[model samples]
Target: MPWKELRPMSQKLEFVEKAIVPGANVSALCRDFGISRQTAHKWLRRYRDQGYLGLVEKSRRPASSPLATAEDVVVSIIELRSKHASWGPQKIAGVLARRLGPEAPSPTTVARVLRRLGKVKRRRPAARIWSVDGRPRIEVKASNDLWTIDFKGWWRALNGDKCEPLTVRDAFSRRVLAVALVPATTAAHVRRVLELLFRKHGLPSAIQSDNGSPFICSRSRGGLTVLSAWLVSLGIRIVRSRPGHPQDNGGHERMHRDLSELQLSPARSRRAQQRQCDRWMLDFNHVRPHDALGGKTPAELYRNSTRRSLSPLLPTYPPEWLTRRANKAGYVRINGDQVFVATALARQLIGLRQESELRWSARFFDVDLGMIEILPIDHAYLGGTVMETVTTVRPSERARERIPVSA
Candidate 1:
């Protein structure tokens, strides 16, 4: 009893034909065809106007959009995007706002326009949660609270020369402090570069790095490499990302990703590549606006640290704490017995505080190495008190037993 859905045009034509005939009652026809009088009249009017084509469904969209982005503004956005293809909508919006004070479109509008023009690629959503197995998160409140250092993965130049640049960034301001194409990735080379940075930017309270060469040694006590040990001697805390997990230092990795995106192709030579990296670092620090920093460039928020780099000296300990100087082989004579500490701690003074009758806590500067347990000598000829084993216990683990948890 309902109007035909598959052939609505045919039904409309039929109704119009019948209604056009003399004395055809439109209201009676509307009742018989189960259509409202208004719909019947509308179809008849459409047929009268354009013979039958006018009865076809037309677009419901308005003929004109007055509130849409102006053509000139869209052209400017496209031009800016063409200039900096890697910039996202948020960054583009920031530029547009600076260029066109009150007339700039919002980031959402820019995203929509870019998506419509096939300029934006959809990215897979990343996981929001990341856990680092009981490690306390370092809170960065100021510019020099933490610094992240890493070597950008090696890529070959057009001439087949390797191009690996060491990158260091301030964690709080996201300012890139250094990007140098070192001769090698050895500890000495990295130490030289860091010394230059320290003298220039002063010193950060802590430096973060991944578990890699020149940064950490898996076999060493506390995973301290020579470079990190030098940093520790300068009174800087060394923070390492979890082994095999790059997300522990996600911000630093994200910066590397941006760098990689910008330098898709290698330069002509290593020197040229170094120059390119230097340019990128300059732009990243001064020009590129960061969304996390509320659309401010890293250079705007960064400040040089007040802690100047000084000559490395032996750390003084409490009068009650016993101290031992590590020999060249990283062995310390404790109660007439030789115990091996880390070679990274070689030629450095270590402080020991007795925690129990047989156990003592070892520390290099402020860093706690672990607890040392003294064992009695089996034979009478050997020394009576012998330091047998050094077991590594994290400060967190030691405090977890005594510290009460709040509900």
Candidate 2:
């Protein structure tokens, strides 16, 4: 018979029966059985002591595993993993130790228990090298000093309606201020959500966002849309992450990852999704432990901003800056010379400050609207001079390195 087909119990039984025979040649029996002399002696001893049952296979497991994780600790780890399925062993261990004292299992123990329970999922290493840019770093002095906002990619709800979520997080404390599901990505919807957040949590010193609709306009002046211009008017500094550089707002992106994991499946309706998002925001701020925050929840570090929100009003510039109103065509007329300012600023007051004898800088409120230069109307009898803004539009570079907003 092939060695692969041999059964350990059957082989041991045959060997023990033959060895028990009187005057049996044990060495020849060992050679026929293809087993070592030590193995033959062990089976013979077991058979003499406990008979046929002793010749059967025996357990190789140790009698006691002193270093193994305790049953209660393993159960606790699995329970925590069930709550925060995305959290790894280190975070789970940290939380358990903080709550259950030093007797809690180590991170490695927790990992082993998770593996035994089939709760671990291995992820392949990304082929793309992780890179970060180091520019436009903003200092955070206190809570509400900086806030990062973005839209999680939209998905269809069970009702076949598209649900787009807008998330706003405090950069300093990693507090999630808002997570609202809206029907569209329009400025009005975003503005309403921000206004609610501002009234509740107060206004942040600065708001950071990517160059996208409602936040920026490439064709508009300073890439400022109406919503952004309103923010500038509210005395809030606007900071835009470089185009195509998501790491510029790394903290916000990380939060989006967590949110994506929570939203693995969409809800049936807009109301249901909003309710679910609200509950997640609560748990994220109050319960979830952040590894970067030294195992502290965001609510522990976050505080209400002292810089309270006020009714937004038009901005006023210094008296030296000449004030001119943009006409129906969004043009500022200087001695009958029409210069295009910005279409968004139509019928709005614009401040003009002469940078030089031939050049002038136009601004709406405090936002700059580029420079205009004077050129004489050639071969005209009236000799009226023409003033026009110089335009040199170039595609924005998207590969620029951006420093992490939180780090």
Over 4 Å off, model 1:
1-133, 356-358, 376-407
Q: Which stretches of model 2 miss by more than 4 angstroms?
A: 1-134, 313-319, 327-329, 364-366, 374-407
Name the TM-score of candidate 2: 0.58
lDDT of 2 by residue, 122-195 (tens): 88543221112334478997789999989998777789777789999999899999888877889899999998
Q: TM-score per candidate, in order? A: 0.60, 0.58
Clashing pairs in 1: none
Candidate 2 — worst ten consecutive residues by lDDT sum?
Answer: 398-407
List, in order, the clash count of every candidate structure: 0, 1
Q: Cα lDDT of all candidates, in order? A: 0.81, 0.77
Instruction: Candidate 2: give its CA RMSD in angstroms.
Output: 25.7
User: Per-residue lDDT for 277 in model 1?
Assistant: 91
